[model samples]
Target: MNELLLDLNEQQRAAVEYIDGPMVVFAGAGTGKTRVITYRIVYLLNLGVDPYNILAVTFTNKAAQEMKDRLVKLFPHKAENVWVTTFHSLCAKILYTEAKNFGLERNFVIYDENDSIKLIKECMKEVSVEPLNFSAYDIYELICRAKDNLIDPESYKINTMVSHQYYREIVAEIYSKYQKKLLENNALDFGDLIMKTVEFFKNEQFADIKNKYAQRFKYIHVDEYQDVNYSQVVLLKILSSVHHNVCVVGDDDQTIYSWRGSNMNYLLNFKKEFSTKDIEVKEFKITQNYRSKKTILDISNILISHNKHRVKKVLFSNIEGEFKNDVKIKQCEDEYDEAEFVAKEILKLQQIEKFYNSTVAVLYRTNAQSRVFEEVFSEYKIPYKIVGSVAFYDRKEIKDIIAYLRVVVNPQDTVSLKRIINVPPRGIGETTILYLETLAKENKTSLWEQIVKIDDTELSLKVKNSVWKFLSLYDLLKKYKDTMYPSEFIKFLIEKTNYIKMIEENNN
Candidate 1:
């Protein structure tokens, strides 16, 4: 027996060894899911499978890195060859390789949320649309939902027309113009990474590239399978159609991303997907609850059993100690009282109950609920850390600076161009931006291209000077990019754009 199989239980070992057509591991919370996944990869290596033949896909870059680290520890030399990455990253690799086939430049940029919203707002400005009935955020959500379902703009417009006619007209127009802008600027949003790849694979032009990928990766393993959307499922199915050695590990009870269009239906009916191709599926359930005691498992099992739609499985505790502590339930008069009670109980657990080694986690339904608990914890001087909510990159000034950097990196990025065009309240206002947008559309070129040849005779002196100043500043930065280091370029931008002075004036 291999050393990797030593620590796994019967079901886990079975999953690691099952190398058939298709398999599903109904991994419950606290089960060693990553262990089974990594062990399976090792099992394939032990069987003399080429390391490059295996591909592991997870939900986040961090998880992918962790999986790579584990694999490197087990197989130091061969681990580097295995392809491990998030779905978006996988699609990005595929797209980057075949970008020229789709008329997109190899240097195409990826627009983040702020860049995407800024582009959408600029598009709205061109059409004289007000925010009374249609907001940029609302339109953004609609576009995301459409892409998640692999719905093209034309089909989305048709569907919207059949359902909501008024929004149909507006959204369809906006979606068409938005997609045109993205293509014109040679950029893609986060959703486009998946959506575009799916479209490319379905086209006959992608035959050679798809065949190369499908043949290269003989084994495919997807973690967090329950949160896959329509576009992601299609990509996986296409890639694995060649060799049906696909293994998906997930639990239906953990499907909480439906708000983002992630459907658990795909996970629940996963086997049915390959039935037409006659791929046999072996299902394994890991029910051993390693993290909780019998009392907690019993309470959880009862609570989840009431749900009508789910895979039938029991989480049985495997702990050695007899944990017969009754689950505590407390009632509070208000939110403040609840916070105080939770804070006191946490202190008692740490000090009096000798649970010093046990780290406590306070769960909240929403981010706003953290404020009351923070106040209570501060009153008691309790040391606590909030996990995963605040993102430093989401700050306003930070995004503004990133927008400037994106424009410097890729001059064709009109999304970034529009974002910082008048960010510090330069003389270029909405009317001036609309004029530039109309001129670019009429001339069939990028905003930067049109700005270089601006007809300042038609503009008022203030607006004309502002537009020229904006263009000159960008050109100066381009020249500086050749000699100045990144830090020096940032300082130059602050001084040239007067960004700091504007902030100070506003503050005073």
Candidate 2:
């Protein structure tokens, strides 16, 4: 046996060595699914398989990075050749390379949630819909759900069934306009990354491009298969259709992203989806629980057994000893009671049981549930640190800086251009922006292009001068764009735009 397969148990060893055809591993929680994934890659490498032919995808960047780090330690020389990344990151790379086929530039900007909401609001305003009547975020989510299910704007308008015809027509119009604006600005939102890649592969016009990638990646592995949406399933199926060498590892009962369009059916019917007449899809179960105690595993098995649709598997603790003290259940009348009980329990655990605050953790289902616990913890004088209160990219300052960078890279990015045009209070107000938008609509051009031709528009001299100053800032940055490295250009942008100075003055 290879050294890499020495530590795995019998079931995990079988899963790692199964390289003949399609396989689905029903990996229960705490069963070392990631370990099996990484070791399987090692097994393939030891068999003289080219690392460049392997592709592995997971749900989160952190998970993908962890897999990559483990691979680097195991196969330091050839690990970099494997395509280990999140689905969105892989799709973004494809979109960036083949963006011209989809009528977008290679340097297209990717809009975040805030940018998408802003554009949705603009579309609503253009279609004569009041923000008060319909929330911009709600509309943005609708469009996202549509895209996740691989529904384009035209298909949404015709096939979608809504309660009110008026609202349906309104949303369809807004969706069409929003997509048009995204293209005009040379941008794609986060959803567009996956949706467009699926589109590119499915389009018959791009058969050669699709075949090239399908042949390049001979083996595919997907983690968290239960959390993949319809578009993702289509993408994976298209890529694996040629070779049929794919392995998906996930527990269907662990599916929790249904609110974001994740369909557990894909995982539940994996055998049916991948099995062919010549080669039957193999199924393996890794049911040993290494992270939890015996009592916890028993309780989880009992609770999850009641689920109507799931693969039949029981998880047993691999740890020795009875371990009967881990399982506990508490019921409360409401969130307040639950919060109070949790805080008091934590206080007891710290004061009497001598457990450190760092050793204890409180898990909640939703972020909104944290408020009550926070209040209760404060009353009890318990020091707590929220793990992911606000994502780094979602911060206002970070977004503003990214917008500046986006504008520098792609001048047609009107959403980013609009975000930073007067960010530091350059005297060009909303009224001036509205005027420019109107002129841009009339001339059928982007906001940046309209600003370039501002002299041709009927605007106040003061507004025109402020706009000219903004244009000059872009001109200065464009001059150094090819000359300086990306890091150097960012530093130059912050200095030339006085962004850091504005932040310091505001803080003071």
lDDT of model 2 at residue 135?
A: 93
- Encode model 1's per-residue lDDT on 266-311: one tens digit a residue: 9888878755546677888999989988788888899999988889
lDDT of 1 at 299: 84
RMSD (Å) of each candidate, 1 decimal = 3.6, 1.9
Worst 10 residues of 1 by lDDT: 350-359
User: Using lDDT as the measure, which candidate wins?
Assistant: 2
Question: How accurate locally is residue 479 in candidate 2, as Cα lDDT from 0 to 100?
Answer: 82
TM-score of each: 0.87, 0.95
Measured on C-alpha atoms, candidate 1 has an lDDT of 0.85
Residue 294 of candidate 1: its Cα lDDT? 79
Candidate 2, 183-259: lDDT as tens digits = 88888898999999988888899998898889988889998888999889889989898899999999876978997
- Candidate 1: segments with Cα more than 4 A from true spot: 126-128, 160-162, 320-323, 344-360, 375-389, 421-435, 438-444, 454-508
